[model samples]
Target: MKKFLTLLLAVLMIASMASCAGGEGGKFELGLVTDLGTIDDKSFNQGAWEGLVQYATEKNVSHKYYQPTEQSDDAYLTGIDLAVKGGAKVIVTPGYLFEVPIFIAQDKYPDVNFILIDGEPHNADYSTYSTSANAVGILYAEDQAGFLAGYAAVKDGYRSLGFVGGMAVPAVVRYGYGFIQGAEYAGGELGLAAGDLDIKYHYTGGFAATPEAQALAASWYNDGTEVIFACGGAVGNSVMAAAEQAGAKVIGVDVDQSSESATVITSAMKGLKASVYSVITDYYAGSFPGGRTLVFEAKNNGVGLPMDSSQFRSFSQSDYDAVYAKLAGGEIPRMTELDEKGSPSVVPVEISTVTEVA
Candidate 1:
């Protein structure tokens, strides 16, 4: 504990000195602290950063980002502390992993405002979840986005599907469950029985690219799974690599990942860039919804598929519009973490099985 505290103190002190310098232009008033990935991972971190950059560049506000040295609660907290010390007025944290750290930081730096995307603040034990007056939590309707992906796949004639998630966090779970729901919905449209569609599900335990994840994806492809929804940050890269090797297709997550690889047929996209830009705008306009958790879903145009960039042969723009209308208009009921019993029962048990690959 002593050694850890000493290291933390050193980090904070260095950050303080940097803040004091203020560079030639001035201190960076806007800050972003990344989770376990770089800003250009073409997923979570990048999406959020793009929004910040767009807003900051237009407003001529100084902005910077700090990456943690490790992937633990302490390491994450350290990153926040550094941002605060470095004169960050408003800090944006882009994933659920920030829940605990932002929980602690909200109290530690009461004057600094925070925009927490994809999660709300909560203690480690989760017995308490509270966003202070200085912080605002932003959540996306991932289920809706995932639903679009699954519905499109089945409508376009793919029966065998696989879902590879980075972790079983609430966001990822919502995505997986929505995908299953969509597949079932489409299967019914095609007059197929409950046992007609097949889906394989698993979580990679973390949001990084790994040999194990790639190998597992390759194995699933080899076993006849038609397309895999790579829903875990850099883990998607691993799945995409596997798809390239096996000549299979992929459904990406978080943002428009179609550009990342030709194997990516589409992406279940949340408005990461637009939402961040909007929140920052609100902050500057004195209307930031502090101390509250905000939900961005289809009703508000917060989530959908990138139709213009999606490579679908039969799932035309008209097909997308029909399904998306149902989702956005509440005609389609969404299944989230709350709707699960033990786990999201990939509905119609006879047609589906969740393997939870090791």
Candidate 2:
């Protein structure tokens, strides 16, 4: 009888320990839901996934992430439900596309803490919606990063540049506007002049590579645009194709593209990996910024430019040092000024009669 009692106690102890490790009660279980893109796209999805992975490994916590096979409300909701049902205490939803689904999910699962990157829920009146106390929104100053890239391009003697954006979202628009402002700044500060240098902008309306992005880039290349900033997910990959064929330089977004595309000149980096990692780490540390909106900017090392690699052998080391210093020192405000409605506009730098190019 004593042996039976001892064996039963040992089994209970083991079960209790396993439950704690799996976050069965109060421990943390993190889960991430990727947008339509795969986790390996080496862009937004990849960065967010890396953060989650790093946090999980460091904390020795249970975590998982699911990539959507399609772009639909159902797809996002299904992934969220899966995570919630899987014992997730915290859920990270990457991309602006998840805004609506996350809003609804936050209501459905009030107990699940959510991190919504790149967007926030809004009411019918367009005001920020008050989600459950468990949801936090994350955004970045994309315009500042684009501005740095544009300034660097002009400083490198590439006055004519093209911007190819994915979707008409606020993030993409900020990036485009920031690029224009930077080019204008360089033109005024360095005397490139309005007509002497050209800037073109196009919206692909999607994040993946499509014929539209390639065709638009081809047109820009034919018109003598010296560099292109591709600000879409896989759509940016199309810029590489155009650059490889036209022998023009291109800037990447989210992640460094120089390694993937030998024609890539540089990249406008958002430090997505770091942002996601920090949020998760905070949650583990009981300091998660829940129910608040987090904005990452140059001031926070949230956005900036990447180094020139083999693809950009044209850039001198001095060039990198100069731009990096200016940006880090806050001597250069890479972010674009915007109206209250989040419309992209040139603030602080006033350029009269600035027109879009064909």
Candidate 3:
């Protein structure tokens, strides 16, 4: 009886040690909850995942990502729940859609740290704004990125430019506004009057790469618009398709999408990967700026055009450097605050022919 009891005690000790080492195949310390997309969407999700992967690999930490079953608040919350169950100490949620969901999860799982990108946590009706001590919000100066793309396009000899936005959301609105300003600035630099530059701006009212978006892009390209800055999520894909068919140039948004299509001249990029990596690093270093919103801009190398891949005729890297320095040094003006209707309150450039297509 004594020998049998000793063997059982040894087995129980081994089981306890195994549990402490993390159950099953070991729990992932870092988790990413994708917002309505796959890890390789080549946009928001991909950018965040790339950062997570880079940090995890360098630190030799376990990380994984979970895609929600649907694009509803409940589905997103469920994704967070799953990540926590998988031993995720830190969770990264990308996109504005997670705003409400993260608001709920922050209180529900106070022990879990959250990195909400592109948005802050709020209630469904936005009547309540709260950032728990365990969460931080990340925002970018998207207007700066858009400005770079516009200036590059004009300097590259594209006189007639167009902007096809996915939706009239705040981010998209800022991109359009900055594009117009940048083009106007370039016109001044090149000795062209305001009316000499023609810009067609339209919002597609949705973020998908739908047939209607493609049709609208096709119309713009067919009408002699030399380059169209496609500033939306999957909406850029539609514009790229149209540009390819029409042999027109395109400016990509969000990330460097030059690899997606040959027609892509350059991309107005936000440092999604860099921001994500920085936030995660801070979390591990015990310096996480919890309960605060972080803004990334040109001063921190947060937004710019992919210079190496840009197909510019005379706008060399030096030209880009000068403009970027001006922007960083506050020599260039940023876009005005967006109104409730998602429109810029101020328009610096006299866009002679701004049209809104249904």
Best by TM-score: 3
**Cα error, candidate 1, residue 321 (Å):** 1.8
The per-prediction CA RMSD against the true structure, in angstroms, equals 5.4, 8.1, 6.6
Candidate 2 least-lDDT 10 residues: 349-358
TM-score each candidate.
0.88, 0.82, 0.90
What TM-score would you give candidate 2 relative to the actual structure?
0.82
Ranked by lDDT, top first: 3, 1, 2
- Candidate 1's error at 302, in angstroms? 1.4
Stretches of candidate 3 above 4 Å error? 1-25, 343-345, 351-353
lDDT of each: 0.88, 0.77, 0.89
Distance from true position, residue 223, model 2, in Å?
2.2
Query: What is the C-alpha lDDT profile of model 2 across 59-127, one tens digit per residue?
Result: 788877776668887888898887886788888888888888887888889888898888886543455
Model 2, runs deviating above 4 Å: 1-28, 123-128, 308-358
Worst 10 residues of 1 by lDDT: 339-348
* Candidate that beats the other on TM-score, 1 or 3, i.e. the better one: 3
Better of 1 and 3 by lDDT: 3
Tens digit of per-residue lDDT, candidate 3, span 124-144: 999999999999999888888
